[model samples]
Target: MKNFDIVTLTVNPSLDKSTSFRGLVPEQKIQCKNPRFDAGGGGINVSKAIARLGGESLCVFTSGGDTGKQLEALVQKEGIETHAIAVKNATRENLIALDLNTNSQYRFGFSGETLSEPEQQQILEAVSGLKTKYLVASGSLTQGMPPEFYQRIAAIAKASGIKFIADTSGEALQKTLETGVYLLKPNVGELAKLVGVEKIHADEADDAARTLIDKGQAEIVVVSLGPQGAVLVTKDITEFVPAPNVPKKSTVGAGDSMVGGMVWALSEGKPLQEVIRWGVACGSAATMNEGTQLFKADDARRLFEWLGRK
Candidate 1:
């Protein structure tokens, strides 16, 4: 178990299988290209992105059965240190198919197998035992896990004086906010929902994020605006980083890439402005690659330099 300053937790990990098809027609045998497999889950993908940036982090995830073994192998292939907890149920697999004709990506995600109470407790204990500076709890809560599961991790991070960065949605995210977090990366729509609004226009992003910061839900709130770029809001500072225009390929892991870039930059002691720029650069770079592949180191560096000129 190599020591790391950053630790990522992924309770519901997946093996992502991606492919491309010429056309999408109903019921006919459609020819598909060879599939590409990658280890996926919000936290795992984040670790992959960090690895791409020449950074290291300890990736903690649940593993079971053959699928879990494959997922572990894939993560290890990325050169990420991992701590996998054994479980009885098999891990889930997701499908990402690109329609070449329409340039549309169809993603089919499956629910992860339910974990027993003891299994869930084991995950909690593993997280509690970690000695790190930053603890990132990302991804969704599986069916068997309680909504407060992330909140429990947040409590542990707080008690240990570790900075907690959370990227999740719905009730799980909502509950985690109750315990407060060091940072939050939520898309515009998710930010709207957290602020009790149906939707938020681009101009309203900063204020909406401010609402959460004012509530002490999170110290920093990063609202991702997709193509328009991202905005970072803290108690006294707000900065927006526009996304660099680039040829789009697949958006499968863009958000996770953004989190990874920001976390890696933060670990390096970069300023908040540079942090958000790294996030947007990595996220934009990720869209240039197909399937679950994250950004290339050269690509991210190029984009970051380009952004610095702005």
Candidate 2:
């Protein structure tokens, strides 16, 4: 196996197919344009984002059947290194349809097939054998896979002193927090659920994140506030970076792009503040593109520079 500074694991990878249609009708057939395919799922997208920023990370994912094969080819086309473990079931694919009439994007997602106990063990063994500094585990666990799966990965990362960065939701997020992590990015609603709240307001975002940091759930907590921007909370500091205004298109992989930028910046020895800027910059830039294509390097650099002035 090749050496890498960062490694991303996506237990439920997908083949994302996107298309546009004139309008959505209740029971009538609608004419749709040709579909576009993209390799999706959290960790794969983060790898794609890092590659877009001229950084490299090894992408580890479970793949099976023809869809899985196609997903690997699409990811390779983006110049990302991959280590795909074969599974017993075919990989899942998601649909992104743009209704031109209302300009609203509708996303249909399906859960990936469950991984057997042996297969889950294989993933753990693979990560244990990896030589890396950062271990990024993102996306949802497949059906039948326990929520504590990420917590197990967290243990491995902690024992090896590898910085663990997690981007997930619900029980998975809660369980991972129990093991502690280097960083965690959760949206307002997701954060609220973790902290046992009905909801978290934008103004209260920092305080909410601080709660997690103070509890040792995470050393750094980044709460994404959608179009408003994001708040970076740590033991000593709480900073909010406003998101750059850009032409909105699709938000398919914006969060993944953010993680990619922040991780890449961190790998480059940038400060935490600058790292968060890169994250917001890349995430905002990703919204300027269609489907799951992510962002252009030039656009991200432009946004980063613009954000610095603000």
Candidate 3:
């Protein structure tokens, strides 16, 4: 069996389709440009980002029906090794339509298809069988699955000596933290929720993250501040990196890209400061592209260089 240093799990993957049209008129057929398709979902996109950085990771996701087949084909075409767990339900598709006239993007998302008990077991088995150093479980849990789904994966990673990283929200995020993870990437709002606050200011982000670390919820807490860049906080250190200004087109897949960059950097044995820099660079670069196309390697490299000089 081929080995991978990083493994990403997207229990509920999506076949992302995007296009653009002018204006939003009721009861009118809208003429749209040619649609673009990309394999999406948090962990899948993270794997794509890692691959773009000339790194390799196994992307494990659920597959079903035609949409699942399409998703598998799309990721395979990207040259990423995948292990698709067959499910009885068809995979879901997400739509991103850009209004040319208003220059706005409308995202239409569907609830993930439910996973059966046996199928859920398959996902856990798949992860448990993998020999990897880093195990990333991202995205929302499918319908009919408990929020503790990620928490279980966290337990599996812990037992297997894998460094678990989780990027999710709400109850799912809350449950995963109980199991403890190595890294967590949460936006300011999500971090606030974790700490039982209504909201947290940028100044309080370091303390908020430190609280989680102190409680053993996560070893490292990375608070993403959107335009303000990100802050990396551990038990002993806290560092902030300002975001670089760029031509922003879309914010899709930016967080996954950031996680990818950080995980890849960590795998390469980069220090914490450089790791966060690469993450911010890749995430900012992702904003330079539209839909789920993610970030280009050249753009990320340039952004990373620019960040280093700053």
lDDT over C-alpha atoms for residue 302 of model 1: 99
What tens digits encode model 2's per-residue C-alpha lDDT throughout 33-65? 999999999999999999999999999999999
**Which RMSD does model 1 reach against the true structure?**
0.8
lDDT of 3 by residue, 65-168 (tens): 99999999999999999999999999999999888787788999888988999999999999889899999988888877899999999999999999999998
Give the per-residue lDDT of model 1 (tens digit) for 47-165. Answer: 99899999999999999999999999999999999999999999999999999999999999998889999999999999889899998888987886899999999999999999999
lDDT of the candidates, in the order given: 0.94, 0.94, 0.94
**TM-score, cand. 3 vs. native:** 0.99
TM-score of every model?
Answer: 0.99, 0.98, 0.99
Model 3 is weakest, by summed lDDT over 10 consecutive residues, at 97-106
147 in model 3: Cα distance from truth in Å?
Answer: 0.6
